[model samples]
Target: MPVGLSMRLISLLIVFLLLLPSTEMKRPGKGKGLKGARQNLAPGRVRVAGRHSRSRSSRLVRLPNCSESTESGEVFVDCQDQRLTSIPASQMWLKEPKHLLLARNRIRVLNDMAFRGYESLTSLDLQQNQISLVEEGAFQGLTSLTTLLLQHNRLVTLSEEALIPMPSLRYLRLYDNPWNCFCPLDSLIRTIQVPSNRKLGNHARCAEPITLKGIKLKQVDPELLCKESDPTGDPMEDQRDSTNTLKPSPIRSKPDAIAACHTYFFPQMRMDCRKQGLTEVPTGIPEDIVHIDLSHNSISHLKARDFQGARSLRTLNISNNNMEHIDTGSLAGLLHLRELDLSDNSLLFIQYGVLEDLYFLSQLNLGGNPWMCNYSIHYMVYWLRLHPAVRHSGLLCHSPLEHNGESVEEYVNSYNRECPKDRQHSQIDQDTDPELWQTVMEVQREVEEELEPSHLKAPQKYQIIRLS
Candidate 1:
């Protein structure tokens, strides 16, 4: 066709030939043997890369002084009471230990990755230490950890981030620490109170902010804790953590019924709630509880059915309180009660039927109370006479113009002498129980005073009995 056109086509063909080699080189898996082997080697390289982490973990510093032993084909490191100031190098264990006991040590602060390389730890005991601060991710690499004992430490607050590493955690002892009961403690308290975490945080109590002092961690109302944190407050500063990465998860609200008390099964079932600053009788006493000590409190009144759930209760100590009134049926269903201590109180007189449920009660302590020596005090005397086998003390009169400082028994005799036999028989026949409806003793006293000046007898329907 044309000599110039042929030469242009040949030059284009040469450029195309040069581009062909570049294109071929970019094709994936182009070589049948060498490239295919490289593809096969890729997976091995990835597996080797994955193993590098384990190798690095193994290269950690060693603790040559750590005591080691074998149990059930698993390694155990017992460094408890070693007076350790900090956690030793975790790579001391060739194989991750099953149990690591660092209890009763002097370890104070647990930083992030504190227990790294202890991936197989099932139980870790750090109890009775001075550890007050736990940074987030402090328990990293403890994936199989189950039982963690942090009790008797100085931990005031712990982030949920520290707990996230131990998914298998079950039993956790966090008692005896001075836990600051405030908004900062919400997440940790909630984690300890989950229904599945029943054995966790048993007997842990607050040690600060007077109002919540001595209150159990489980019973301290979370809503009360969230009482509008000051906007000006730096929560991170309040948490006392420099690296505060905790994003507060949704806290759940639960209805708590367990009393803020310490329960014991050894020797015998007992509930001790002394000096707890209680305003009233605590609810939810366990039915199987045999003894309960509630002295040294601020309980001003005992409501009816307060101890109804404690059917098996044999002994109760409620002295050293502000109790002034014992409502009817307060002691109901206490058929097995054998001992009761009601001393050191503000009680003037116990109402009728208040102690009728203690069929087996053999010991009664009513000392240290301001016992009134009036007609309203007759029920207490009558009960004591009927329960002749009961050993009791502190029945002296504390009031009334003539009966002041006299024995309660003497006041009862004077009352019986003044009460007319005919009128007493008639009243007893008319009323099934003298205090059947439990009229207020103060009302009866007021009626007696109102009737005396006019010398008018009480109406037949009224239950006022005047001493002639």
Candidate 2:
């Protein structure tokens, strides 16, 4: 009605009409999120719309700009050996990327929608990183993704929802992760059954529940994994072992019995020289043994001679031993070794060539040892870089100066001081020694002294009656 108000209204209407065209535009082609993008359909390809980022300083490594017209090829996105803390949100541009490589970085978090636009991504390699917390929805948009490589990272818990998507995902590699022993991890272990159930039969079990206590997770009742009040309410009840039966045992350690009969049951018999007071390696490991656990022993030094008989050993765990240093010669015997866990020992040093013979070795664990972590130790990091095939897991801070209060990732990337200045040789600290075999022997001796000689006598043989 008024002249000035009519002019202002006309100007506003013009601006609104101009904005309508931009909003009505159709969704652009894959990989190109910009306003104007030409559609070109092709396998393993998509094009980025915005300016291609060329900055080397961005922590997030991005795949090459794929176009809708491109063909199948390995989409290289190697930001592996960098100091990244998380997968950047900007990586959503690769809508149809085939391969995404982010190995050997310092990534600690994997947030929700981390791969928002990667709907057609097939293979993802996140081999070696410091990923500790992978929040739910970390892989929200990956639908066609098949192969996922998360072999070596500091993942304590894996939320079930984190992997509920991607039904096409197979060949999941989570071999060398330091998984926390808790109820939250039940879903992950159960998921493994879907892949390896027919092969493992009904005997496969989780090896550890508490970190060092070595309680078999399988032996613990399924009810234990659940909160006493809300077990069935949880969906993981289907994964619980249904066979609640136990094998019958004939012997019982009773005072009235003349002799005590002990029976040991293992998935497979192996050289378990733990606290046995044996100076030499045991001789009776089964030929088909796949996992060998020799932890918590007084093994002062290990040589190739010790493993001469083990040919099928794949997973060798020699943690909490008295090893000061290891040579290439010592590990040359384990040609088939895939996972070598030598944590919590007195290993002050490791020669450059120590792991040279292990070509098939996929995982190496050397955490909790007293490493110098100074300039001289730079070669260790460099060596890790050289062997891309061998998964580095998370780097452990063996010294307080390098990682007193920092995380395992912080020590590996930036805080590693690399073998401190040359100093005089210091005697090994007694507190750090892993020689607990003598203590075990002493305890056995005391038990013997407390028993009467009559108790040591043999028990009368019982008649065997086989039930039909």
**Best-matching candidate per TM-score:** 1
Q: Model 1: how far is 270 from its true place, Å?
A: 3.2
lDDT per residue (tens digit) for residues 1-468 in model 2: 999999999999999999987766644543353322324334334444443445533222354332222334445444445566666444444433566666667777888888876666776777668888877888887888776767556776676688878777764655445655457866655555554422211222233432212222333343455533245554323334332233213342211100111111122223333544433344445455667666776666765546655667788888877677665577666688899998887875566777766778889887777776555455566566557788765355566574543435445556323422122113334465455644544454443343325577466465334365
lDDT of candidate 1 at residue 79, scale 0 to 100: 82
Q: Candidate 1, 223: how far from true, in Å?
A: 22
The per-model lDDT (C-alpha) reads: 0.75, 0.56
Worst 10 residues of 2 by lDDT: 255-264
lDDT score for residue 356 of model 2? 68
TM of each candidate vs. truth: 0.45, 0.35
CA displacement after TM-score superposition, residue 52 of candidate 1 (Å): 46
